[model samples]
Target: MTTPRYKRILLKLSGEALMGDQGFGISPSMIKYVAREIRSITDIGCEVAVVVGGGNIFRGIAASSYNMDRASADHMGMLATVINSLALQDALEHSGVQTRVQTAISMHEVAEPYILRRAVRHLEKGRVVIFAAGTGNPYFTTDTAAVLRAQEIHAEMLMKATKVDGLYDSDPAINENAAFIKHISYMSVLERQLKVMDMTAISLAMDNDLPLVVFNLSDEGSMLRVVCGESVGSRIDNVTDGKNRVDRTAAVSESYH
Candidate 1:
């Protein structure tokens, strides 16, 4: 049994990651896969907290571009996150992992209101806590919410699970020559305007010196490997050891299913 590098971590999942091969909505298989991945780490005694995005169902920013009220669109988006959160909780429970759903916005009928101490307590008792509703406010992405919750819970690291292997200089889909970054500095990420996360989230993590790992969730056991500190993805921190450049030769492609 390998000792985990971080006792506690915040795992951030994009709504898009739940869509699988479908164009919209959550894929049952994908959600289950995510649950199992989380369970793998939790079984090793690593406390887990999740922050999932809602872009698969609704994107407030995209709506706002088409004459919709930004706040209203964002509110809808937040609700979408809650939906995902509930689905995730159900799947986690089915996987034999005790789970809790806490929403930033008050909605006691379904989940507990986002109470910092209570959420921490749940994690301390070996329960996986899924944070939903995205900060209970508009204009903030789930990325920011993940960072905020991680800080409040004192997570050792923020692990962002994505479809791709790691951070890249440009969108790999569009740019054939895009380079894969193995490691980077938060400030450099901001300067380059990388899309690993929103600027606000990156800035907050940088300010608090929170380490971030961007890895491919589609790869089996990738999450567990990351928890064991196995260099499974690109890492972003405050260090600048001249190792921030991308490795154009390194690329990984794996099927989600």
Candidate 2:
């Protein structure tokens, strides 16, 4: 058997990815597909922990921008994440993967309260852990929660699943001249104002020297490829090893696929 690159990893999935082609709400088929991909890695002895977002059902920031109280909106967003977490848990169990949902908020009826030791225990027992509720606080993105949980669990790296293949100098969908960055420094990401993640999350990961791999979740087997150390996404860390960014027009197909 080929050895995997990272024995354990934290995957950050935006709530939007759960929507599939739908404009809003979770898609059952989509959740099942994600569960299968996750199970595939676990079958190879790779431990997985996931932190999911809640933008599909509710986005606190967007609601607050419309005049709702920011804190209340964010709390509502947190509930949305809990919903996604439960759905994912059910799907994983159906796929025969042992799973646990630990939430920041105290919800004994649904999930266990977030406990660092227990969460680690679940992973050690070969069960996937799904972290929900976004730190159980307002004004924080799921990105930040993912980083925090990853550090607490001592995950080898954080995998940020997104709609795009990887980070680019510009929005690839809008800019034909965008550049594909295969490897980048965390400082460079913040300096360039890349939208890979929120500044707080990026800074937190940078301070702790946690490497992040941003890749497209829609592509089949993309997650497996990333865990295998294939060059499928833009990797951000403290060092670049003297690699130059490639123009998207020249390397988009080769690098992303």
Looking at model 1, report the run of 10 residues with the lowest lDDT sum: 248-257
State each model's CA lDDT, in order.
Answer: 0.92, 0.89
lDDT tens readout by residue for model 2, 1-257: 65678999999998988988788999888999999989888888889999999999999999999999999999999999999999999999999999999999999999999999999999999999999999998988999999999999999999999887788887766666678788888888888888889999999999999999998887889888888888888889888575546545532432221
Give candidate 1 regions above 4 Å deviation.
250-257
Worst 10 residues of 2 by lDDT: 248-257
What TM-score would candidate 1 get against the native? Answer: 0.96
lDDT accuracy of residue 154 in candidate 2 = 98
User: What root-mean-square deviation over C-alphas does model 1 reach?
Assistant: 2.0
Model 1's number of clashes is: 0
Task: Provide the lDDT at 124 for model 2.
Answer: 97
After superposing candidate 2 on the true structure, give the runs of residues whose Cα lies further than 4 Å from its correct spot.
240-244, 250-257
